[model samples]
Target chain A: MCELLGMSANVPTDICFSLTGLVQRGGKTGPHKDGWGIGFYEGKGLRIFHDPEPGIESKIAAFVRKLPIKSEIVISHIRKANRGKVELKNTHPFVREFWGSYWTFAHNGQFKKIKTEPLGDFRPVGTTDSEYAFCWLLGKLKKKFKESPQPESKLFETLEILMTELHQKGVSNILLSDSKHLYTFCSTKLSWITRKSPFGKATLLDADLSIDFRKVTTPGDRVTVIATNPLTSNEEWNLYKPGQFQVWKKGQIVFSNE
Target chain B: MCELLGMSANVPTDICFSLTGLVQRGGKTGPHKDGWGIGFYEGKGLRIFHDPEPGIESKIAAFVRKLPIKSEIVISHIRKANRGKVELKNTHPFVREFWGSYWTFAHNGQFKKIKTEPLGDFRPVGTTDSEYAFCWLLGKLKKKFKESPQPESKLFETLEILMTELHQKGVSNILLSDSKHLYTFCSTKLSWITRKSPFGKATLLDADLSIDFRKVTTPGDRVTVIATNPLTSNEEWNLYKPGQFQVWKKGQIVFSNE
Candidate 1:
């Protein structure tokens, strides 16, 4: 029903190349044209741009595309509204602050009756089932751990259990980040690719553009990008299995429920 | 010290003219050049743009100045960075969600030893005293009222008491909003002007730009602009006294401690 694009990197990086490909799907290459939003995490601070306009047609999106605002974590979404009306409030990705860190979430699929779930301290400002689900998940997390859980693996395990419940509701492909890591849960479609020292030229599947990663990146730079669909035609994107959950840190997959 | 600019209007209005003047203070006209941020409220949705660069030189700031994004409520800040480092996380115009509404805050003055205060559910993502004060204030409010206070006046009264506590800590000139209303607390410098029917031309004090409000607005339109200093040279702005608080709705002063 929508598209999600996310990036996690060992160093501050820009998603302009990948974003250019994905935004094409927002209107020109695909039908998801209701609205779009993106969040870029710079250190502990997160800057988000939200527009209730077709990503391909938005001036803000154009500015974002042209300007390379570097960040270690980024999440973006292009919407085809189903549960919520096409409005600025309903646009993804949504954000909430937790444990003194900003957590950003974007959904790519639908959920049945997700709004009926109870929320804790976190509340949804928008009417989307996606936002309601995020609020429910984060509220539950906050209730479980008064602060960020020690032994980070425990947090991952709890997220797996909570996300599985959401998977049972319906298609629940999600991209979420908490400044330090990118967490992904897939119920249906999801794919990711990691580019490192041996980076080569890659052509976009949706747009008439190509980038030679070798020219722009250093040998030590590692960058991982996740999306609902593969953005590059030549890159070897790892497709996620249904009901899988993965956690990425510093451009590498540190945990996965394969 | 920093600069604050806020607007409350009966209808959706763009702050391009005022922003053009205020941004000059971010570097060219004044010394507040550490960072800048602005939040524009569209219904229940909020769109924010943040730049760590001086507002006068920031490309993002330039784009924002040119874009006519209409909003009914707006909160903006240009920082001089006293309590925190000149980083994205330390930039002002902090936000938190309470009772399903997004509360945006922008401060113009420093709060000495404010971060020493205890907090509840809300936490500060950045090490700025201003953000810490916001978290403490909101956490206290959330603790007092599990939901938004039933009687709106009670919330206003409670805010006055809480803000008075902040005033005790140090200078705490703040412009805050919760979608429906703009709540301002002044410990030092703050000023406001309401433009209604029979509007006239207004010229910027910091810049050479001038706007004829009569040509752009209808008689039914009412807009209130709040700033750390009066943005226009020709208009009469009412200055706030120390320890003064005011609540604005539909561009009119609904509550005030004159």
Candidate 2:
């Protein structure tokens, strides 16, 4: 099993504070020390770093901690081998190009006996069920929608139907984005927190770190963070109901249907 | 390294569509197939799943693909070995209880030569620096605000300073949450997207998938997603600039300083 961390903000921001606390779990406070990767969105582009080493002890991780990369959206992961050899190719937060945009993906669950036909356009570069699923999904979407782009509502509806079908096979919890919006679904555990103008204090549970929101943000800024679990001790985290799904855009909930 | 996925929305929604595509990366499309884990925030609690197998081939992953777990917030991760022998103990998305609330954390990146003195209350259960960092952060937060919670502004100010110091040591891209608000910092790469009533078509770059947002969401809903990279091929993704910090609350950016 692995862990997940993400951030969505209206203004460009760095995830250093939350990441500082979460990175500790990679090897110090928690287990999950296998490899680690992170990606930052800069306008229409992405900056990514991946390492086949424990984040707590790897030099790459140290470099990342020190670098100050700011963006409106961010995604990160730490590895714990479950399938495939521990190598660079097998790292999470996989990236690919499509429709002239770079797409990245990562997973934290296993799928059994779930096989899909070889995708003509998209193929697996590695041998993990997660990759296979990604290819299959892409194939399905391409098949369903040709050249014309659909509206958000229609797109979400199709996704909901597809998700329901996929969930029938096994457990699935996921986070996805294309730089414009974030989508999430849960078959198990997932939590989130949002910060706004009426800021307050937040104490980290994994580390003895605390932050005062009032000083860091303005009245107009809004931020939403999603994780597998809560990261603070003093804040109120909103837990997703079982079999729930939601989407976030611009620091606010855009769609939800549990 | 592990992979992370997250979503936030105004209305309840499922991430099955995105999860399906992401799952493929766990073991099929890309790599990251050592073990997988997921967390879904349900109301005030979280539903979680951890599997010590490739998500593409694991039975649980298959089942999850079809599950309909829904939520306003979601987080997921896939693993690839980097530290600690591959086993359940080393999985990511580590959970802890603090201030009567469940906190979760996930890290991407590595740290080296971390020799910070061990704190009193928090300690590492694993040899990974990630856990040590978590403990250190928690310990620091506890020590800073031992008596009462400070204003969010004050807390964030202190955290910013601490994060800047920690960043000087290593690569640190992280996500942390207490259910109400999310904190993010990027020492490296991270990206995000937001969706609202005027949703449009989104195509997956890793897979041949696309969604029409207009079909599934209401006009009042908004969603935000953050990741290490973008997941779609046609949508615009916002990247974090170098050396940035920010906070998210209620689906909007609350504080930011790049």
On DockQ, the leading prediction is: 1
TM-scores, all models, native as reference = 0.99, 0.50
CA-based DockQ, model 1:
0.90
- lDDT score for residue A210 of model 1: 97
In model 1, what are the clashing residue pairs, if there are any?
A: none
Q: In model 1, which regions exceed 4 Å deviation?
A: none
* Candidate 1 global TM-score: 0.99
How far off is residue A253 in model 2, in Å?
A: 1.4
After TM-score superposition, what is the CA distance of residue A177 in candidate 1 from its true location, in Å? 0.6
Stretches > 4 Å off in candidate 2: A116-120, B1-258
TM-score of chain B of 1: 0.99
Q: Please write out the lDDT profile of model 1 over residues A1-258, one tens digit for every residue.
A: 999999999999999999999899889999989999999999999999999999999999999988899999999999999898999989998988899999999998899888878888789998999999999999899889998888999999999999999999989999999999999999999999999988899999999999999999999999999999999999899999999999999899888888
Q: Write model 1 residue lDDT over B79-183, tens digit each, in one string.
A: 998888999988878988889988998887777787677888899999888999899999999899988886799999999999999999899999989999999
TM-score for chain A as predicted in candidate 2: 0.93
What docking grade applies to model 2? Answer: incorrect
lDDT of each: 0.93, 0.68
Top candidate, metric lDDT = 1
Q: For model 2, how does the per-residue alpha-carbon lDDT over B1-258 read when each residue is reduced to its tens digit? A: 656666766666787777777778888876888776666665444545556678788766676666676666676767776765555434555544344344556666666655455663454444556555666676687677763265677766766666665666687666666555556677787787888768899988777878898998788877887776777888898887646777766467777876
The DockQ of each candidate is 0.90, 0.01
